[model samples]
Target chain A: MTVSVPHSLDDAVRLLGEHPDAMLLAGGTDAMVEINDGHRRPNAMVIALNRVPDLRSWRHDPVSGTVTIGAGVTYTELMQEPLAELLPALAEASRTVGSPQIRNAGTLGGNLGTCSPAGDGLPVLSALDAEIRIVSSSGERTISVHDLMVGVKQTSLLPGELIAEIDLKVRAGWQGYAKVGVRNAMVIAVASACLAVDSEQRRVSIALGSVGPTVLRCADAEQQLSNAVDWTSGAVSPDAIREFGTLVSAASTPITDHRSTAEYRSHAVGVLGARLARRAFATSEGAAG
Target chain B: MSNQFFTLRVNGADHEIADSWLGESLLDVLRDRAGLMGSKGACTQGECGSCSVMVDDSLVCSCLVMAATAVDQEIVTIEGVAPIGAPSDVQQAFVDAGAVQCGFCTPGLIMAVHDLLDRTSEPTDTEIREELAGNVCRCTGYGRIIEAVQQVAVQRGGAK
Candidate 1:
């Protein structure tokens, strides 16, 4: 159980290229939990990413209208200023993750790495159409957030590839996240949804979580709501909003888990979707306005 | 296997930990090897803040941090919050407010309160509750804990 702490991205990827099977520890929120619970045993080298300076900073390119966040950036950092203002839904989701102790150590990359269906950050990334930059000693590549998540607790990442940064466009509209759990703070999502309204594109995107094997996008609901919105006035009728919720509920493929039932999850996601849509397009002065 | 040795700087003092497993958590190293028992381990998971500590400037669950990975970081535990045999202002407030019921979650709660006040001088009720949400106290029902924090805030020049 040798531990390697690399201070640079180059060295970290190089080590990873060498030991493709090495366990990558970022934030250690999930990995450490698995280790402590004896759910996972590692005989391979452990590569810790906390010291890599390149993976801890975020850059907002106003010209490009995009923000690239390093894989090592903690949730606490995401919920703060500058980034918070730019990525509102992500910030909201970050605030709901675990607790102050968990948020202080958890990272979006860790959330992506874990790739759980209930991951708080994934639904936001999905609705935002986030791009993931993957790197290795050999080279680098980019993939959409939707493509990166292959299944529950799985990713499409190759053996040596590590998530370098998350790219999110700064859209000109209202974007928010909401989740339903037994309690407010420190509870995993029984059901969650993210709504991002792209005024420029005249599109509304919706994504659901904890209801399927992966974070799912409700294309039908999104298209329906987008079409219903009065682009000039930014007004969405109540009937449209109701139908949108029904579409979202139809899109969900939830199963009965210990935390919640399938019927409740399906119902909860619809409510969350309608509530977020109503908030986004609340009045004549809607998200576009 | 040969012993894996590393040095951790805790509370302005450096302790050398030998024969440590790479899989051991910072909580394990602190309590078992460094002999610093102030940071208690309850859940051994991040859900419970019993093992909370400051790694660098951030307050984190020590159980979630790999011990070896914290080699170059500054670790501050409950013992380091004040001089031995003396209570810090926060600790004294906890006693005064009757925040201590069983005293098991006191250290972590104290660390959390210190972290919160250090960041926000006079935190609002919402801010205080949100900041200390991680440290769950089965006893006291959190009313006294909030009182202790509010008392410390006013005493520490954090005007309401």
Candidate 2:
């Protein structure tokens, strides 16, 4: 077997472009499990991206209001960085991933590559309207998180392409994440929600995970809440908020699984969505005050 | 497999190994070749913290780490933390609190606690819980384990 370790992003790009069949290994927290489980029998080649220094660093562009995180950056790094405050939901989700060890080794890019509907990072990325940077042998391109995830265990990633980084547009807003799992730690979610509110723009975004084929946004609920609330005062009518929860419930398409019943998933999403929205609204008010 | 070789500095020692199987996990190499038995191979999955070790000062599951990737990095295992003669403060605290029951999860727990105390000398109960949440224990019910951590925190006046 050929295990290729590229020390630079340029080298990685060239290697990936040259070897389309080689499996990309980042963090290896997930890839190793797959290999051990016999779920994936990699051919003679494996591309190890952890050694690429450029893929492990992050930078913020104040002028563009964007925070670009390297694909190889681990969750533990994110929790201890300044980005924790700006992306509270994502940070919170990262903390609940597996365990301290897993968080320290797992990369955001690996989570996206898995494309699992129950992935904790997906909901928050969707809520934040995050953009993913992709690089192939030729060049780089960017796509919305919502567009990248096509379905359960599926993504828009093509062969010979690698995720370079994830770019998040910093917005003046408050956000929170909550999930219902079988256990307190090291468990997958039955249902989860991420709520982001941009009061200045009179916009709200709700992303629901584990209750559908992919992380889904509650567009109708967002629109209803945005139209009903007074953005300047950060006041959202209670009755309209209740209706927003109802719309979010209607949007879920959960299935009965070993972890939870379909009914429970739907109910949890509705309750958690409403609770998160209220918390985000409160945080915004506190910041404004 | 290629004929390339790399040197790894683990636990204050340098060792050269073939890079052909660089994709192999560090856990396997440490247990099979290095003969460092402190880090256990429990689930072989990242879910269990049994194989927890420090890579360049960051705690990570050894099972998920590639041996080649760990080249030029500093690694700290349970054996490294507690040499043959002396033990770290956290290890002593574990013994004092009666936290070592079955002992299967002791090394991982000690590493987690070590990292926590190093980062936050005075961590609150909530912070301790958050830090230890990642390390699971089936024995002692975690009550005694937590008590042991609190005892250390109190002895050092670390908890505010």
Candidate 3:
């Protein structure tokens, strides 16, 4: 076995390019569990990406209203950073992951790479329309989070490619994230929803996780809500919100799992979607009031 | 694994070892080789925070951490967090609050509280709950643990 620690991005790219069969190791929270459970084995080499400095920084691009989060930045860092205001839902989700110990070690990229249906970060990223930055020896490319997740525990990541950062458009709006679990903490999400309302743009986006093959946007529900309510007026009717929730429930295709029943997940999505939407609306009201 | 050698500064002590299994978890090495028994091995899975440790002032489960990844970093186990004779304020608070029911989850809970108080000197009850949510204490039910943290916050005058 080979363990390669590349400190620089160029070196990391070169190493990944050279060892196409290598497994990338970041926050090993997910990877280690898989390895221990005999789900995955390191091929001949393991590329340690933790040492690459550039993959752990966060910066805001004021001109574009975009915030770039390095893939190696841990959930703990996200919770502590001042920029968390831009993505409060993400911060809230981060707070729900594993524990203080898990948050310190688990990176956002690891969550994205795992691509689990119940991944806490996925719904937030989907709701935000976050862009994932991938780098290879040849060059770099960006893909939307929605397009990156292919299925359960899978992604569109190609061989010899590493996610460098996640870019999210910063919006001056209110957002909320909520998840149903067997217990309040450290458990995998039964079903999760993130709601973001771009009040300035007069649009709303809702993302659901653990209720489908991949994190999915509730496009029909969003359209219905957009057409039904004057989001600018800041007064969304309860019946309209309930209709949107029903539409979100229709969009869910959750499976029966040890954590929760499929029916419960579907039901929770609708309730959670409406609750999150109401919370976001309240936050918006608080900001405006 | 490649036989690369690196020095790990754990709990203020530097130890040199061959990095043959660079992909091996720091938790395993700390238990198997380094012989630091402070961090437990309850759930080799990351679910249990029994194996929590501080890496560069951040609390992380050692089981999920790659040993090679911890190279050139500083780590503080439950033993190092408090001095041998005199316990840290958080530890003292845990003892005073009678939070150590089974003592199995105490180390992780203490470390979690340490990190929480370090970052937020005056964390609200909700913030404390959020920070400690990752830590599971099947025995104590977290009542005393929360009380301990709150006691520390009160004593510190909300100083993180």
Candidate 4:
């Protein structure tokens, strides 16, 4: 019945080492609901890490072509000026999050902690080839977003390890996020896609969410389109966009769930992929991102 | 387990409540402990904005917030925004536009509109709808509620 608040990363790691079974509470947007519904319980202890200073900030290294977002950076914070400019697709996805209230409290780390396939930020992370930064009293480790999400609401996070931040490259390209949902707001994505067209590398990356067990990367699509599109000129033909869409849709291994059907999810993601690709082709601002 | 004495500052006033569960929601603490009942407890989850409040200038559903987490944070409930006998322009606008029916969702809506107006002086219809998407009303069909927002905007001379 103890709720432990740690103020520093060392203190947090120490708390985790001491109480390996304790539940880590960042924003508690999803954790609290599970506790209230009697679906889950924090055994013996709850480590409240929201107050930890080191986990509450972010930094961008222009020379390294990467941005490291603190685990505590909420959706509300992500949608603001500087961070939004650096990661516009993530910012765009953040806007579609539950509500202002939810955005205010929900954190990027919390979304990773939950590891839900429907999580808005996951596809963006996948598209960007993001890496999750994990820490413990023992040491620190980094894993790709592709490997981090093992399954639905699951991860490979070991005992006593806490996610510290998300690290991703700042691609010199066009980036956009689009989702199909039941409503204009506050609805879980039936299907969502994040498209990042890297002009400098002459490549395209597409990630789809809620259509499979995990946030899925369209390797076939990215591979095929990298050859088809003229990435140097930042131009993509409509035919290329359609071909990319078809490949992304084929990548999804969806199931019929309460939110949507497998066929519809497939179709919706294809459409979103095509639309975002076309949008990225026309936009000039994402090269600096 | 030890119970800590939690002190919360709400609407320019401080209140102390002892021996409360750490997992108790901020919505419950405001209504049950501090006796500020303006934010209703309709949905204990994050979906319904009936328990909306401002915590450190950020809008969040109090139901989703832990009371232990909200300590020392500045909180403004609907009661604080418009005290018992006195109503803010947003509150009066709801009355003027007949936005209240069952009246349970009004306080939260008022708080939401209040928060929105604070940020954007003259928000468009689409903007209003998008911002208040979290606050759901079963009555009034939302037509008058939208009207009420416009009423407040007009009454304020397109300024906050």
Q: Score chain A of each prediction against the true chain A by TM-score and list the results.
A: 0.97, 0.94, 0.95, 0.95
Interface RMSD values, listed in order for every candidate: 2.4, 2.4, 2.2, 1.9
Better of 3 and 4 by TM-score: 4
Q: Give the docking tier of candidate 2.
A: medium
Give the alpha carbon lDDT tens digit for every residue of A144-169 in model 4: 98888999999999989999999989
DockQ of candidate 4 relative to the true structure = 0.57
Q: Specify the CAPRI tier of model 4.
A: medium
Q: Give the distance in Å from residue A57's predicted Cα in candidate 1 to where it truly belongs.
A: 0.3
Angstrom error of the Cα, residue A235, model 3: value is 1.8
* TM-score-better candidate, 2 vs 4: 4
lDDT of 2 by residue, A1-289 (tens): 6677888999888878878878889989888887656676666678888778899998989998889999888888777669797677789999888887888888888889888899888898899888999999988789998889999889999998899999987778788889999888787899999988876677999999999999999889999888877777777656666687789899999999888999999998998887876776543333332
Best by lDDT: 1
State each candidate's clash count.
0, 1, 2, 0
How well is each residue in A1-289 modelled by candidate 1, as lDDT tens digits?
7889999999999999999999999999999989999999778889999889999999999999999999999999999998999999999999999999999999999999999999999999999999999999899999999999999999999999999999999999999999999998899999999999999999999999999999999999999999999988888888889899999999999999899999999999999999999889864433331
Worst 10 residues of 2 chain B by lDDT: B15-24
Indicate whether candidate 2 or candidate 3 has the larger lDDT.
3
Ordered from best to worst lDDT, the candidate numbers read 1, 4, 3, 2
- Lowest lDDT block of 10, candidate 2 chain A: A280-289
Candidate 3 lDDT, A120-204, residue by residue in tens:
9989999999999999999999998878999998999999999999999888778878999888878889999999888788788
lDDT by candidate, in order shown? 0.93, 0.83, 0.85, 0.87
Worst 10 residues of 3 chain A by lDDT: A280-289
